[model samples]
Target: MSSQYRTGSRGSAKAKVIALVGAGALLLTGCTAEAKRGWLPNVERDTTNHTGAIQDLWVHSWIAVIIIGVMTWGLMLWCVVAYRRRKTDTGYPRQLSYNLPLEIFYTAIPLVLVLVFFSFNNTVEKSINAPVDSEVVVDVRAKQWSWDFNYNYEGQKKYFAGEQAHLNTDGSAGVEETLPTLYLPAGKSVTLELNSRDVIHSFWVPAFLQKLDMIPGKTNYIYLTPQVEGTYAGKCAELCGEYHSEMLFNVEVVNDAEFKAQLAKMEDGHIGEEYDRQPNKVNSVVVEHGHEEGGK
Candidate 1:
């Protein structure tokens, strides 16, 4: 009777474990598309050229790490169970001072893994950063707490001077009307020439899975093709100043007609000489204040 009870308890425990695991898997499977994509921003893979490649790299890297982790942990658990010290054991099992083959295997395996990751990363980086004869060129000027976008197309330039974003008491950033916007035509190649009028800032769009720094006295560039028509949130990734958190912008990927219409509206408002010819003078007062605060 006791043996039967023990057997029944073991069976019940295993059933409970199996049921729990099944339930968890069901929940995972029922998750939204965003959750399944590891909580990444909702981006259409087919439309967005780089999104699919980046997401694949990210997911594959995690899968590889998980496989290695499980193997390592299983080996450790097996060693503990199979070769653990026992009461009948008289002395230490055979001990080895060196394991040449094992050492070479472990070292080589990690090196190979690193090389594989590096190769994939390099390929993606090159593909994304490769220069293209872009249809649109945007000069993105980041300032103390605002943004300035200059759109250059067909020998004409239009500019929008964005105001500093207002922060809620809870410190959340949102799409406010005053915030500047960048418009790109879907299915067209675009290049963003990143510049800083004052200190350093970073242009980050989470959905794009990339960010680049804007350093004063230097110019950087980002090359991409927007294939999906949507509004994506953008923000400064680097900590610049007191209102760095409010350094936000919006990217609107639209059809070619809409993009051209938007630029046409800004035709009368051309890029100013202060911002275009003299980038440093756009916000000299704020820049000086930032420098003083930094010295303190």
Candidate 2:
């Protein structure tokens, strides 16, 4: 018996050591919390309002998870350990059913929980739906397989054509995925005006926790605020075309000085209107070629 006890203790000690070593290794490798959210990438707390609300929801969700997990495990353990088939109660037992108060207790508790869930959901919705007064208004245009941005600062909307940058078309200029990536200033609310030319598309930024639909012939708006200074990526959440996956944009949150510097260089004009002053060179050449072909 003494020898058996010694062997069991040794095995338990080795197991504990292995567990600790594994935990230490994970921490050293920075593999823990691989699925954790932005708080770690940033040690200081987030100051943005949207992130705060999201954090609150996240905390509440975790609370709900723990509450449910404990209740399930504790109830199961109590039933098995305390209410087992004991020798004292080995004989047949009285059957019982139809406890109204217990039934009400179960039903009412869950109903209250559901009500809480709805309440939190509504709060999140309200936070998202409010009018964003300080946000930068960006007009988005969706074409064959690329995205374009038209920044409307006040009444002057400057179009960032992705014709030369690979971020958008074949090798066109990159679309602002999150818009103003590192170029947008902080503490300002941005209202994105979304539209599509051919098919339906959706813009989504997970970090900002907001999404908007891009419908043809109509425009949609969404509000976003970046609380922290870091790079956040956005993607076309809705399927629009063959190269839907290629549709990407970036949001750059920058300081005030940097933002103003970039904003100063913006210039927007109507290309069609510009042609009215003088016909397009390509169009003029095409017309001349047509006339020559007819004469021949």
lDDT of 2 by residue, 48-139 (tens): 55766766776788779689889979989998998678777867766677889989998998899889988998989787778767547776
How many clashing residue pairs, candidate 2?
Answer: 21
Per-residue CA lDDT of model 1 for 1-296, tens digit only, reads 69999999999999999999999987886476556655444666754578788877877888888999999999999999999999999977998999999999989999999999999989988988888889899988887777878888878788776767787777675546667788888998889889876688999887787789988778888888888888888999999989887888888999999998998887444442244324434433434213311110
Candidate with top lDDT is: 1
Best by TM-score: 1
List the candidate 1 regions with Cα displacement exceeding 4 Å. Answer: 1-36, 39-42, 169-175, 267-296
Alpha-carbon local distance difference test for all models: 0.78, 0.62
TM-score for every candidate vs. truth? 0.78, 0.65
Minimal lDDT window, size 10, model 2 = 270-279
lDDT of 2 at 149: 65
